[model samples]
Target chain A: MSDVVIAGVGMHPWGKWGRNFVEYGVAAARAALADAGIAWRDVQLVSGADTMRNGYPGYVSGATFAQALGWTGARVASSYAACASGATALEVARAEILAGRCEVALVVGADTTPKGFLAPNAGDRPDDPDWLRFRLLGATNPTYFALYARRRMALYGATETDFAMVRAKNGRHGLENPNARYRKAFSVDEVLASAMVADPLRLLEICATSDGGAAVVLTSAEWAAKRGTEKPVAVRAISTVTPAFPQTVIEMPNFSTDSGVAVPDAVTPFKSAIAAAAYEEAGIGPEDLSLAEVYDLSSALELDWYEDIGLCKAGEAEQLLHDGDTAIGGRIPVNPSGGLACFGEAVPAQALAQVCEVAWQLRGQAGARQVEGAAVGITANQGLFGHGSAVLLSV
Target chain B: MADGATRERVPAVEGWFSIGDAPALIGNRCTSCGTVFFPKASNFCRNPDCNGEVFADAELSRTGTVWSYTDAQYQPPPPYIPRGDPYQPFAIAAVELEAEQMVVLGQVADGFGIADLHVGSRVELVVETLYSDDERDYLVYRWKPLS
Candidate 1:
């Protein structure tokens, strides 16, 4: 199969802009087209990441965005995989190009999140697990993050100070990224002093919900060479794997976990399997990654990704941070784009935004927050239900 | 059924726990594989290895150890009911039941905060009124740390 290269990447700065998602997505799409030096009409296919918060158009975002982009009559597709929705869009576009259905594809994701916690759509449907989670136990999203954070502390001797360090490091990187939402630097003490939103996870340690958009232009490696680009960053692999049966971990929107008795137990957790699948498809290991952009929904969760992504051994993520291996100029910089801590979260846009950062870093386009000599990058994120996505990119 | 005149108490989501003094969580244990599931798996065993379609109702352990905990400082959006005058923060806990060998989440009992609990602390399930209306009192499970 031919390699799919990212010819261009673009994003509308992540923050609460109170703008319609269509406008943000369109703006991003135009920027990507201009960057790729391709006309909108020349694109053979378009894919959009779905946003549940938005009404009718969100469900069919590919066509919605296509109509706004002047109806080029290109093949269109839309996907909804919660947090992995953007990657799902990328998956669709990559498949289209690889299948020879299109020579060039445009992928886009955007969202304007509501203030505070995200809730299920209005209704009294008890059958809806998302609704039952909130109505029955009041188990909001943050509660889940806190549960994981606290569990890490208990099992691994991770401390609150360690979580604070993640916020501080990301805060520093955020100041340099103009597209980031919270650009101000925060001290460890400041992070600790911030009001506690969930036990063991202060408000500073959590990512906020925000509005943002990201887009990418993708083409076959041959086409990129034909376009005369000396070197185009290529997506080596995209892994979208579901959890194994008898899921032991208590994930979101669930009151309980699958029983573990019948099965001996999974050697690799779901998150680890997510990244491992990507590495396997890319024929690369974690040691080969020059940098990583992980889903830092909470500071403590970032540490978890370290182990999941194979940057470190299990129960050793805190040590990796302490050794500064995850810093911008460290052995393997993680989330040098400042991560979701600084970007907050724009849902569907976030996965693409992570890839956008890697695309820029591998191309040496990330200005102040650039990881020196960056060549290979990986992005890891898990969605609300069972969607887990990872994309490996290399120059 | 505490009192004949007491307001009708309803399980918050129905089929979770029954109304009684020694209330235990209602769960399902795969008859063929012996895997237990909370919130009751009705159809089949979730284990991928075992394709057991037979499940029997099982009562989970009433007491467990705290696996982890948190406090929700902000009012979670609907459909979580906020009962206070202007909504108050509440503590939540993830308890690990030894018998079932699974962790379950529940709100910490009233009067207890995050500071009052820690991992490995013993906690027992207790039915408490989550919210009440003119018709009935909505009851849900809470985890109470043993003194």
Candidate 2:
């Protein structure tokens, strides 16, 4: 199949919107269309990354956005994979473009998250593992994150200060991002002083949920050239890969990780598998990445991403962060747009937004936090329930 | 309602059971591949190649070791109802069954504190009523320390 180019990318700035999700989505979509110098009526296809609203999302999301945009009738698809929703939506857009079903397609993801922990819906549904976890165990999202973070600390000799330094490092870059929710720089002392949310994690260490929207307009290379765009940002790979079977013990949204009772064999952890898939598809290795954008749900997770994405050796993420190799102006800056830790969790929209950051950085348009001469970049995020994801973007 | 479960009640799903003389704790065994599943497989087998007939019937081992544990500091949103009025923080755990070779998640029994448990600590399953009234009893499972 042919490669797809990202003609335009846009977002409605990630904090709380306090309005219906459609508005932010439409605004982001309009911005993308304007950026591409194309009219809404001219778009041929639509894909949406679903952000669960109330309970499950509305079935007709494409039509929902279509209606809000005054329905010009485009081919529509909606995809869900927890946090990876954004990249998955983009994947669908790229598939349509490559399949020749549509030359120009729009991929949009938006969410106005509920306050506090994103709990399972209200009901007594035994079949539903999300509700079962809450009804039976009262395991909040933070608890799971704490389990993983604490495990990293134990196995990797990663310290709380190392975790705090991740925040301080990201916050330094966040201060330069006008679109970020928390742009104020933080000190290691400040992170240490923050109130504890989980055992080793403080309030500042974890990302908060927020309302945000992002959209990308993708087109075939031929379409871009025809539209007089000299160079369009290309998506090298979109990894919607899942974990292999006989999975090891790990905490998931609704259940404890699957047991490996049948055999002592283990599958690659979901995070590493995501980056590996991206590498294979792109025909590029980690060394080619000029910078990276990763889901920093917690400070520790950022460190985990460093290892998972092959930026450092296993259990050596702290050393890389300490050496400033993953910071702005360093060897390979990570999360130069300020990751989820600083920007807060926008759920669905966030992953698509990461690609937008890559596009800007690769185009040398990323002011302040730009990785000097960045040509290749990668974004990594994990969706729920076996849905792990990443995107390798190149200029 | 912080006050009364007497207002209304509904029976839990029939096939799902935590504990009983019949031995509860749901599971699914693949007829084609003999792959076993816990908490019972509702539909087909998840195995990619073996489009097996998934039979939803099996009893889980009562005794196991604690894989890990943690507590929820905040109240969870809907679909999940907190037993006590409003809601209070409570502990959750993963118990590993040697026979099943899988970890199952459950609430730690009441009065079970975090300090009382550690990974590899022995534990067992128990059928506990999460919430009940004259009309219905919401039966659930818990991981209790093996005494």
Among all candidates shown, the one with the greatest lDDT: 1
Provide the lDDT at A348 for model 1: 86
How many clashes in each structure? 0, 7
Q: Per-residue lDDT of B1-110 in model 2, one digit per residue for the tens? A: 55753554332445555446434577766666666687666567665555766574677777888776666665666555667776666666777787777777777777
Task: Name the runs in model 2 displaced over 4 angstroms.
Answer: A54-58, A259-267, B1-28, B54-56, B83-88, B126-139, B145-147
Q: Which candidate leads the pack in TM-score? A: 1
The local distance difference test score of model 1 is 0.90
Per-residue lDDT tens digits of candidate 2, residues A1-395? Answer: 33788888788888876777888888889988887888999898889888777334434556667778887878899888788988988988888888888999988888888777777655567677777666655666777777667668667788889999999999998888877888888899999999877656788988999888889899998889888864588889999988776666464674645545443444567789899999999899999999999999889889999999999889988889999999998999999998987778888888988988898888887789888999889999987677778999888
Predicted candidate 1 versus true structure: per-residue lDDT over A182-261, tens digit per residue: 99999999999999888889998999999999999999888988997545888999999999876878899888777666
Question: Model 1, residue A388: displacement in angstroms?
Answer: 0.7
Model 1 alpha-carbon drift over 4 Å, by segment: B1-5
Question: Which residue pairs overlap in candidate 2's backbone?
Answer: A121-B78, A121-B79, A122-B78, A122-B79, A123-B79, A259-B102, A261-B101
- Chain B TM for prediction 1: 0.93
